[model samples]
Target: MIFPLTVDRVFADRTRAEIGRSVLTVPAPDGTHVVLGGHDSTGPEDGYPIGVYATPAGEGRAPGLADDLPAVGWLRTARPLRAAAFHPVLPLLVLGTGSYDGGYFFEGALVLLDLASGRRRDLFADDCLREVRSLQWLDAHTLRLLLAPHDDWEDRAARSEGHLVDLTRSDWRAVPARSLRPEDLCGPRVPALLPQPTPPFATPDPESPRPGHIRSLTELPDGDILLTADHALLERWSAAGDRRWSLPADPRLSGGPLAAVAADGASAWVEARGDWRRESGTFIRIALTDGTERERHTTPGPAGLLVSSGIPLLVPVPAGYGELSRSLFRHGRHAVFRDTPRAACTCDCPWDDDEECACACACPLCAGDSMDDEEVWLTVVEADPAADPTRLAFPGTERRRQICPWSWEPGETHYDGPGVWIGETDLVMATVRYDGAVRVPKQGFVTRRPIGEDPSGTPRWVFPVDRTATALDIDPSTDTVLVALSDGELIALDATTGTLRARGHVHVHGVPVIPTALTVTGPGRLLLGTSDGRVLTCRPGPG
Candidate 1:
């Protein structure tokens, strides 16, 4: 059941150029070829056809970031990726993808990809069969497929399609349905998004403020909360649970969703994008007093809130290149051209002057890849938009490490999680560790580090949580670190000692929600954002 998949770097670049998205990867059973799944821009009327391709399964190579692999075979089928399985003994593959059509039928395709001949054929030409839920091989000559019903809206008896195909047959469409064996049906495989249940420490406030995906929130100097919603809506709420003023959604700012907001005096900076896929965005300056636009300017790339010395400035935000940016932050590597070798040098020394390193190894500083190679720096961004604005980068030591799937080399550690600013130059970050593709969060440790100087020295303190931290904030007055865990627990910790102080449950309307963002409005008072698009004002009573 385990078919390892290597990174297909060229597939995304190629798909993006064709105005499409590459979403799924299915490696062949024999491990010589792999199948790619996605949709292209030009498609038929039914829907976006799933573009399937078989490419060579390159093994042992370093998987160069720039090398492009040509497709050995191709199949364009309607619908997205569903279930796909390769024949146990032949050079044949079967896949199905589709959903309930708006009409009375569930229209989809059961496609077969022939690796030996580079040809594709659909088993069914009509819109009667539902999506193929699972594909399995009973033997070398027997292939089994389980499909959903064509229509299941009425009170009729539930029906499912199961077919045991004879590989010797020329046409699969004529194969009659038969009763499935226990081995032919697969159990629940795809996970559903369900809320994690937890005990409620605080009762739900019936009059909770309803906001649609609170993207960014900040407490103003006068206790007003300025926040942005899913689209371009900007709103201000008073301390006494009242909506002060809301700016209507503007079509001019419809580049993309509003990413973040940073308040400075009477003006607030609201970042709006045409879309996350675009390279440029706009930062609109709006008056906090009346929700009116003051001014705005176009930014070069995706910009986010970066706080330095209590001053919020717009800075470049890492898109999907978290591992690459982290390597630059820690190792000071700078060249990202496709031609540069990933293992150019094995020096364990930081760059001395950008021309060379202190180690005797011919350092590849010039040909290295980096975010900013000028000096050591500590850059921090909130796991969510509203946790805190803390970005720190200083000179750091180089450590040879294992690579996460996202990194280009085997030297970068992925700490791309929430961080809360605890001091002028110190913050606590949730570190992520990977064992190949499996995330090892239990072995992960939370470390507090100073960002104003060389970070090679021992950290101030280290602690382990054994769980993923969804959001992190700090009570500046008490130095108590606030952590919103992914499992619906709100934890408080001593910031200076890294010791657990207390823990409590968090719920929205008596239902547990995974906290996505948090902002401490005041001592014992806070605002919590949930994954289901809710903004709740919470006041923790005694215990």
Candidate 2:
């Protein structure tokens, strides 16, 4: 029986909005204040405008553009920040912004700002060069710069250029520094923000055939392990951790990059993802016996592979700026332009209905205009090799057929992560939280729902966890589902009741282990693929 309930019931716990990332920071020489930089939109396509704020050093708070920070200045660059520097012994600031133009050239400007008088000027005299990788004040009057390549032409020697400018000069023009090398300039590095697996306990010998970064892993029917690494290679490992075979996922032969892999009786199917700008992928079948190529078929966009009842199903993952984009736009934050609604309501209502209602029923400007613009309808692609892949709607949400209306608070963005089948009928899934500039799956929850076509079907229960689950597997003997967390936590939940049965941390030889993949090898025994390119087996007990 289906029971109608409040939208809040859809979530195990209330969701919260996440803060965006900071652009660049330039601190005062005395350290009394810090000039922070960031953008006001989702990306450069939407005329991205970056803002600069001077916050008190002791305040210890990084404020967003929407926050009530004292804005020292703002720039309408329509570009992302690349480098920034504060002038010494002078009331001035230099900010650089640019990025790859999605095509041939890297473009940006070097803006000189007069902090005392609010005056600004673009220092570049012509379009001969762009993109400041770093800046250093050579002295009180001269500034040093390292500009990225003008175009994607060739190697670093041909693309990188450097300049030196004396602000005291009448023109303040930049002159090419012939002796400057790319290594002479330095700035903050782009971090590996995504959660990563741990390295092996000890480094491999220099000559060992190293398995690159593991993306995903699964256990084969014959007790062997199969995994995709670096989006290029697929390798098989024996039950005892011996390398069986490795195959290259050449884009010409296997779509683009290896994404999802599934195994059948004697064959395995691999999905190679498409480029970010397109919505197509490739599905290739390989022989399990010797890792030989078999057949290939064009498939759907970057998706997950699910095999049930001897059938292969492709679940399409949403592209960029999905439902969360709408929420961000509604709350006065930067989001994609298409995601912004044509209209919205400001009144408080229990439900968004337009007819037979008492609240704003006749108002055309009410909030009842279907809040389902970009809702991702869960679907599956057929396994036809000679015909176009047909998309059939599965048991997920669609436009105006929401199973769980969003109940997240302002500033919080939510994302559904990977899932696993607990039994023949019930499906276990995880929802992650967006933090800073990336989605931090470590901060999410788990839920279990039965297989059905009802859009409003309620889940069996929702189990909120403090850490995000990186992988999941079932221990059929104990009727328990094991969740492997990115931070090395192993949680066992009752498959029938959704109750937490046990919690343990994964460690090896006193070294903390970060798990990237996991599976139940046997009764009470678990196998894990770590970020450090190593496989380990452990039995959770009182340790």
RMSD of 2: 18.8
Stretches of candidate 2 exceeding 4 Å from the true structure: 1-213, 249-264, 278-280, 300-304, 315-317, 321-374, 378-414, 422-425, 433-442, 453-455
TM-score of candidate 2 on Cα atoms, chains taken together: 0.46
Top TM-score hit: 1
lDDT of 2: 0.49
TM-score of each: 0.46, 0.46
Task: Compose the digit string of candidate 2's lDDT tens values, residues 1-543.
Answer: 011101111100001000122455556665544554432332222233334455545665544333434456644554566677777767777777667667777777777777767677766645333666666777677776656655666644424443333234322323232323334434333311111222222233454333323446666667777776433446677766677876764554322222233423666666554443222245667676787777766643333344433344444433333221211001111111111222333234444334543565543335344544433332222243332222222223221122332213234444555455653445566656656554233467777765444453356877887665667777778887777665556678887788988776554322334555665667776666654455665664443
lDDT of 1 by residue, 481-527 (tens): 77766555677878889887777665321223345567777776677
The candidate scoring highest on lDDT is 2
Clashes of 2: 11
- Please report how far candidate 1 places residue 293 from its true position, in Å: 2.2
> What does the lDDT read for residue 297 in candidate 2?
65
